[model samples]
Target: MPGPGSRPASEGPIPHLVLANVAKRFPQAASPAVDGVSLELARGEFFALLGPSGCGKTTLLRMLAGFEMPDAGSIRIDGQDMGAVPPYARPVNMMFQSYALFPHMSVADNVGFGLRQAKRPKDEIAARVAAMLDLVKLGALARRKPGQLSGGEKQRVALARALINEPKLLLLDEPLTALDRKLREETRFELVRIQRRVGITFLMVTHDQEEAMSMASRIAVMEKGRIAQIGAPAEVYERPANRFVAGFLGAINLFEARVVAATNDLLTLDSVEIGARLTVTHDRVLPLGTEVALALRPEKLSLARMPDSRWNNSLAGTVRGVAYRGEASDVEIELTCGKIVRATMANIGGARDTLDIGQPIFAGWSGEAGVVLEQ
Candidate 1:
């Protein structure tokens, strides 16, 4: 389990969900689908399992929902071991990517299906279903069948159905993928709002970086069936644990370098890629001549017609390509050493001065802008 500092501020001392040394393997696969994975989730925390396909995020989710059992280790919910619990008996509901609402059933019936199966009173189910519909903003569409609802509407209906059970945790498997891009973006905030209103822990599995970064209070980035890094979105994005994490999060320019000078608070590196010496701030004194890589995000590098004295590092390059992306323009610059570096310049004041291809440019960045990583 992670320390208290890893817990969300709203969480209590006890974790809502705990996975300890969890491992799983398929019958014919050479490697384990989930390997020695462990993490803790706080109560009411909106957490996300973020990774590409075949990274074990979905498998871990299935285990949490009791659809799949771990071959080794244990899963605990609210401090109770879930080894013997079945899917229906577990206090977890899953809203799958497909929504999976019954085509023949009315919206109200679909939302109330779980309660009806549990043999609750008709009046109680109706009342709870009505409240859930209102919560998801589908009260007006309750009488309509799933076939009549829009993609977003069907999604809300499925969400209402899942929440009507009042489960301790909700599992969302690619919850927003079915919607169009604009609608998907809109639903992200809507899902966050609904989760806050319900006040239940939401464990979502997703391959979309934007969805996880925007909606999750914390995210676990999985790679090759193991957690590469786990932290708040900003922390994981800004201070990635390794090269894989830095590259996976977004576009970054990495310069192969070696530590030439080291002090208590500063380090100097000779980078062959940039054809320049780079100075960056560091708290620890690494050994001289240690190989390392300097990582700078595209947004962190500023391009100018002339070198800026304020920059701790600067390199001369020719603009190879320029791409306009509305709010910002991505410029690809080729250094004298033939290394390519990308920089994103904001399109402030509507239309700014544009840089032409093959034009001379200087990319500069402050010492604080770069992150040092082990090769």
Candidate 2:
């Protein structure tokens, strides 16, 4: 994770967009909306700003669009400072979460509205509009009004409008929020296709972790008006910088650990909660008596009916909770030491609901399963 983090934000070739120590605050507000944040986005990269509502994800996107000015730091796009640039003057376009398309205008007209406002030639606007419609697979519905189109179709229209300007950077504010679950899933792939076709840097703000994981090549997880972590989706999800990022991306079991012994290749920690000694295969030495956190995703743990010595950590427990989720089932096991640990098992060879509530089971995990979290 640390190795992956070093590249996109700091080590890559000159970025297409750079936000350096950016901060913004509202009038008399208790805290800044965006606080001391910096990130670099590569050319033609699909980057996601992911967090809960009011976590400054939307605020960051707004800053990129020039809708709100930052009180501190600077923004640079393609080697140009944006300090004096107005919203209309910037080489960027934003597609809002609402899909702000004109209801009265036809799809083609809506897509071409920006071109008309810019006073481009009529022939060029017509040809570009037609090409964009065909790009989004909406050529047949070019004459349809926004009200007459489905949610997905309208979203395509808004996207076409944004791209018609040929922005160097494109900002998307929860672009898939309006669609149904099925459509949203379908549109995720559609978005990837469209972004690849356009070959433009995409900066998207989304609260959906799955969306970020699936669509973004990299993600910046925001917390309380600041960035908590930024890296490739898998790297961030598997090796989070702290507890907030670890728990925010997905469900995981946490244990407070105290280092009891350390060696060149591993550090052994004692956790009273599980009444077990856990080993971590660490690249660096963990000092003795140091307090740390062990984060284990549910799927990384294995539960079985019989005891096995395959894992460094294993414990006897009783099943407390069970949730059947089609492909896999989540089970909460209460260890004899009065601690609850969750495990997810794929329903492949065995019955879907094998672990009955109150049934005895064994929970186990290898040293590599846990990520030693940072404070």
Candidate 3:
């Protein structure tokens, strides 16, 4: 149980769902699919499970959707234990990766299919279907078949169908995988709007880092059937739990260092590459001979021709490559210790004026910007 004032599994003021020590395993598999997973979802919150492929993100979601049962632990929704609750009986709906819209049926019929399954009155079903279509801005396309709609339209129809039932929880499985980059980015906002408007708990599974970071109120990063870390977007990005997460979430530079001196406020580390001293802000006490990894984000570093004395972490390097990304240029620097560090600088004018390729430069960052990870 969550303490008072703490966030629940679902998003809003109410705690609608809870997973306690949920674990699962499959035959012929070496380990569990979901191991000791527990999460509290406040009602109406949007949560995202993010990871690389085959990291048990999808399997955990399936267990929540009633498609798979956990081998150990329990699942509860709104204070009711969901033991053996069949998929149809659970107060949940899923929008699959394929959209799964009926190719032969019109949009209205597809959206109303769930209501029809419950055997609601024809008028009642029609009203709900109309409202759902209008909510998704697909009312004008009600008469069109799935084949007649564009990729985004078909996705909206699928969303409408899933929401029409008014389920307590909505599970989305890579819902935007089929769309182009531009469309995917646009639809993310729409999904957030729908979730807020309906006030339903949404649990989404995605491998896309940007997608998870953009829409999810909080994210749970899973690895090898276990949660590696869970926190708000900024918390996870700025302070990853381990080396894997530091590498997976975004562009990061990991430097191996040895602790030279330690104190309550700061710890000085000797870099293996540049042989210069590195200062870090740490809460956990570190021994003088400890080996640690320092994680630094690409954008946190500034490149210059001379060392910045004010910067706690500074290194000299040779420019490796410069790639223009329209809005910014990615500068890769090869340090004297044979490690490559990347930095993203805004293209104020253009990459043509930015740091030239093969130029020697110095990279510097503040102490607070680097996070020390044990692994």
Candidate 4:
């Protein structure tokens, strides 16, 4: 369990699903596929499990879907224990990365497959299928086969099929991974709209951090079969728990330092590369002469020809490389002490030959911008 200030496995407001110390391991494997993991999802909340390949996000999703059982601990859905529940009996449905639409069947038949299999009345099934198709904006194309539709259309059919079951929870496993960058970005809002419209709890598994940040109400970042952190997208990114979380989420510059002096909510650290004391805003108390790392975001730093004394932190460096990225230019600087730092400057206008290699510069940042990482 984490404190009130920290993100907990499950905090207050009624959990719709709970996993208490869940664990799983495959035979002949080096370690547990999913270690002792505990998490909770609130009713009608959209949660995302984000991590790289082989980090156990998929295995965890499988356990929730009743496709695989946990070796240890317990799983509960809406206050019911699911240890012995079969896949068909679970109130959940999955939309896979490939969409898995039936190529030969009409869109209406495909969407109604789950209802038909459940032995619902034909008239009732038809009604639900029509509504689902309309919800996904594919009502006019209901009579077409999968091959006649575009890639995004096919994905909507899969979503319609999954939603027709009226499951309490919906699982999406990289549902937009196959689409191009532009369409993937567009579909995130559509998914959010669908989830909000139906008011169903959605647990999605994805390796794309941007996708999760855009759509999920909160995110759980997993690494090596364990959760690294869980919080709102901005919280996890700006207030990272450790070095791993800070570096994994985006571009960051980590500088090793030793504490020199400390006072309430403020501390001074000494780093060889900085050639000066670094000031930081910290809520946690640390003893004198303690070692820690400062996590600095690239965009937080401002480069100038002279040191900006008002800013609390500054270092002299030479611009070593520059990369143009349309809206901003990534400038790589090699400090006097040989440490490399990266800074991103907004390109208000076309900056052709703006910063030449070997040009001397000073990088400055505010004290509150740098996060002191204990780990």
Q: What lDDT tens digits, residue by residue, belong to model 3 across residues 1-375?
A: 223224553445435888899999998999878889988787777888999998888988888889898899999998888878998999999998999888889999999999999999999998999889899998899999999999999899999999988898999999888999999999999999999999888999999888998988888899998899888777788889999888989999888889999999798988766677899999987988898988899889988899888898888889999888888888999988778999988778653567777888999999898999987
lDDT per residue, candidate 1, 1-375, as tens digits? Answer: 233226555356566789999999988999999999999888888998999899999999999888889999899888889999999899999998899999999999999999998999999999999999999888999899898889999999989999999999999999999999999999999999988888989999999888999999888999989999999888888888889888888899999999999988899999876668999987678999999999999999988999998999899889999999999999999988889999999999576598899999999999989988874
For residues 1-375, what per-residue lDDT tens digits would candidate 2 score against the true structure? Answer: 123445654335556789999999989989888999999887888999999998988988888888899899999997799988999989999998999999889999999998998999999999999999999999999989999988899899999999999999999999999999999999999999989989988999999999999998889999999999998899999999999999999999999989999998798999877778999887779789998988999999988888677888888989999999888888899989888888899888667448789999988889888898748
Compose the digit string of candidate 4's lDDT tens values, residues 1-375. Answer: 223234434435556788999999988999998999999877778889999999999999999888889999999987899999999989999997888888889999999999988999999998999899999999999999998988899889999999899898999999899888888888999999999999888899999888888888888999989999989888888888999888878899999999999999998999865677899999987998898999999999989999887789998889999998989999999999888999999997575548989999999999899999988
The top-ranked prediction according to lDDT is: 1
lDDT of each: 0.90, 0.89, 0.88, 0.89
How displaced is residue 4 in candidate 3, in Å? 16
Which residue runs does candidate 3 get wrong by more than 4 Å?
A: 1-6, 9-14, 349-352
TM value for model 3: 0.95
- Please list the residue runs of candidate 4 whose C-alpha ends up more than 4 Å from where it truly belongs after superposition: 1-14, 349-353
TM-score for each predicted model, relative to the true structure: 0.96, 0.96, 0.95, 0.94
| Alpha-carbon runs more than 4 Å astray in model 1 | 1-5, 9-13
Among all windows of 10 consecutive residues in model 1, the one with the lowest summed lDDT is 1-10
Task: Compute the lDDT of residue 211 as modeled in candidate 4.
Answer: 87
TM-score for candidate 4, please give it. Answer: 0.94
Better of 1 and 3 by TM-score: 1
Number of colliding residue pairs in each model = 0, 0, 9, 0
